[model samples]
Target chain A: MKKNDIIVIVLVAFLALGIGGYYFATRTESKNAKVVIEVNGQLYKEVNLYEDQKVEIETSNNHKNVLEIKDGYASMVEADCSDQICVHQRAIHYNGETIVCLPHLIMVTVQSDEEYSVDSVAN
Target chain B: MSSKKTATFGVLVALAFIFSYVESTIPFNFAVPGMKLGFANIIVLVTLYLLGSKEAFVISMIRIILVGFTFGNLNTMMYSLAGGLLSFAVMALAKRFDGFSIWGVSVLGAIFHNVGQVAVAMLVLQTSALIGYLPFLLVFGIISGVVIGIVGAELTKRLRVILKV
Candidate 1:
């Protein structure tokens, strides 16, 4: 292989490794802490820090949803829709982690009302 | 172009569009919005190798727009468009470097696709907080892209005789 080709290969390899390292290192297991659920800038529900608990959410639009936070591992236990994306999410026990159900527009996060971080995504 | 070549291109676009539509129906539904199976990308990659960058790009864009219309989600069009364009651009650029096979190009494309979407999210939300999620998306993107790319490359190899383009 040419010298330039080797350089390109190394660069791509480094980039892949960097991305992989960043992903694993930043993963936080919030298996045993308070869990908060919010919707449209409103405090909707809060589960006392627990290893695992099934919390059901009833939306204004007449949607039934369940969030399970167990051992700091949080996930969507159940959902009203055919596609259960929330259940697939790993529990977030970090200060700024979130699980959002775009179809239902429901956002389950680990932050409190006092934590002012960001607003809704545009479009 | 000859009528035969035109016909082949038309057929390829149709196949890509169908693949894209079918893929949309497959519910990956991760809590992370925009995360998807992207199985239809196999067709795009195959087309890229068989027909070259220009044709592959056309096929990719056509599929994206067709799916966007079928889904009828005007709001999400921006995000999809941004991601698709970014992915294709990265793959095309990587095609220039030696030893960067189709799989490598696909992984790079996937990485850029996520980056584009996240960039859009950050701009739309007017906050950098969402940027933190980039690492997670990157890891998944690379893995999925590699898998899909392999399938696409294999498919292209099989079709080479039939598609003499």
Candidate 2:
């Protein structure tokens, strides 16, 4: 590779690392985090992350996703969507962490109670 | 366009479509959603260098649509289109600038591809929190882009001599 090519690669790598580092440093573990689930950009459910439960979300389009919350973490255990990308994603427990199922238009986000309340107030 | 050029475009599109199919079957189990090896991009990059940016764009679009119908759904197709368009735009601009080598252009395309896909995800899901996933996707994009760039540059060199373009 030429000098310019190496420079571009390094710049991109550094930029990615910087953004990733910022997110990592800002991620705060919350004791009162809540798992907020949304379907089609609309709020579907909000449950305490500490409370272990399974949320079955079926969209109007017949797409289905099974979200399981346990041990202060939330994950998609099952999805009828062909890609199954959400099902294979890692669980989220820290505030601002998210699991998204694009086909089903489902998003599960972990937000602290304070942030959740602020979000609700804004909405 | 010359008939030979048209035939080459058709063959490139078919090759890109097959690459998409091959990539889908590989079962990339990276926990990050929407992450891909971007194998089909190799063909797109080669086309960009061999033919032209406009030809490359046409091939990329056709490949995405064809693969979408055969192995993906509308949602997937939308994501692919978003990624493909953005990726192609960036690569074409980089080529025009001529500041970087083929590897640099390929890396940029790969990185922007993920960015475009994530942008669509944020819009469709209506949650900016998905931005948190950008770093992981970016890192993966760089790795995959480098590999594809190596293969693409080699193929472009071989094809130029064979096609005498």
Candidate 3:
């Protein structure tokens, strides 16, 4: 194999592991932890762990999106507009979990005391 | 470009849209949202290698605009444009690298696309927190880019033999 091919192979392997690791590290099963919702850096509401309820998060853009918390696992159930990307997001159940709806500037995420920050790409 | 080349490019654009729609439908359970195989990029890759940078840019732009409009994703147009442009520029630069092939160019393009999209997200949301997802996106972008690039390169090889372009 060419040197460039080897480099690409190594790069691909490193990326796969990094991505896989990030996903596993950030993911938390909603077994015992409580459900918390935050918007625009404020604690909006917290879903009671004991109840199976659907939380409707109304964003500033007037778009209504729903998060269903059943038995502690929280996932987006429905969205008003097309391309329901948030609705398609994996269920997040941890502090500092975030699902951003760009059109609305609304971010629905779980919050943990731990800070989870990723790097920004140069322009 | 010759009439024949123009017609070929048109066909490539159509193929890109078809692949885009097809890939968009095959759902995968990934951790990140809005992540996909982006198989349609194969056409763009092939175009870049076979035709030239400028032609490939036109083709990529046309594909994004057409697909976005058809899907009514006006909000995502900016993100897609930024990502696509950055990717194309990266691929063009990759062409300058020693012994660079279409595959290398496409992979670089894909990585740049992910970076560009994430950058847009951070700026639009005015939050640096979203940067956390960049690594994963880059990793996936490279894998997907290479796969699409391989397909594009293989097709270009066959076309070079058949069409003698």
Candidate 4:
């Protein structure tokens, strides 16, 4: 590899590592994790992770997302959206993890018992 | 372009379409939504090196459109167009630079491909939350890009000898 090739490779690698480290470092730990479901940014439902339940959420008109809470983890079991992004996302149990179905404007976030702190500086 | 060259591009476009269709048949998922091995890019790389940028752009666009119509929706077509255009532009530019091999060009092409897809995702999602996926996507893009680039460059080298171009 030439000098320029090395430079490009190293540059992308370093940038990815730096941002990845920052992401993991600032993650908020959820002591008592709860599954928060929002439709078009409005709170639709909240469920405790400890409980096992299958919730069928209808958000933004006819869009539906089926969320399953099992064994202290929340997963998007099914969805009627074209993207199926939320369904493809792995189960999220930790604090600050989210499964967002963009086409349906449905956001599933995991929140801890701690009070909400709006930190706008992360962007 | 001459009729002969046009026919050649048409054949390559068909080959590109086949590569895309073949990839879809494989049971592969990286756990990242919309992530693929991008094997279709091998055709893009080869077309760019042999026929030039404009032909490469045409081939890529036609391949995306054909594949999009076959197995994907309108949204998929939009993302494919955006990603294909940007990757082709970056690869064409990288090829113009001196001393950077086809491998390097392919790597750049793949990275920009991810960047382009992310840009479209941010626009479609209408929220910055998905921006959190950038770093992870970049890491994946780099590794996959390297593999695709090496394979693409080797194929290009072999084709050059076989085709007597």
- Give the alpha-carbon lDDT of every model: 0.70, 0.90, 0.73, 0.79
Segments in model 2 whose C-alpha atoms lie over 4 Å from true places:
A115-123
TM-score of chain A of 4: 0.81
Deviation in Å, model 2, residue B18 alpha carbon: 0.4
Tens digits of lDDT, candidate 4, A1-123: 567777788898898888778878887756567898877767899998888999999875787789999988889999986556668788887776777776676778888865543343443
Ranking by TM-score: 2, 4, 3, 1
| Predicted complex 1: CAPRI docking category | incorrect
Cα deviation of B108 in candidate 2 (Å)? 0.4
Order of all candidates by DockQ, from best down to worst?
2, 4, 3, 1
Please, what are the lDDT tens digits per residue for candidate 1 over residues A63-89? 988887676656777888644656676
Estimate, for each residue in B62-154, the C-alpha lDDT of model 4 and write its tens digit: 999999999787777887888889989989999887656777777788878877877887676555656666776777777777888788878
Q: Please write out the lDDT profile of model 2 over residues B1-165, one tens digit for every residue.
A: 899988898889889998998999998877887788999999999999999999999999999999989998887899999999999999999999999789989999999999999999888877788888788888888888899999999999999998889
Give candidate 4 misplaced runs (Cα > 4 Å): A32-34, A38-44, A59-63, A80-85, A102-105, A112-123, B162-164
For all the predictions, what are the DockQ values?
Answer: 0.18, 0.73, 0.27, 0.44
How high is the TM-score of chain B in model 2? 0.98
Local accuracy of candidate 2 as per-residue lDDT tens digits, A1-68: 77887888788888889989999898898888888888888899999999999989989888788999
Model 1, chain A: how large is the TM-score?
A: 0.63
Highest-scoring model, lDDT: 2
Ten residues in a row with the worst lDDT in model 4 chain B?
A: B27-36
- Among residues 3 or more apart in sequence or in different chains, the pairs in candidate 3 whose N, CA or C atoms overlap within 3 Å are A95-A110, A95-A111, A95-A112, A96-A110, A96-A111, A96-A112, A97-A109, A97-A110, A118-B131, A118-B132
Tell me candidate 1's TM-score on chain B.
Answer: 0.92
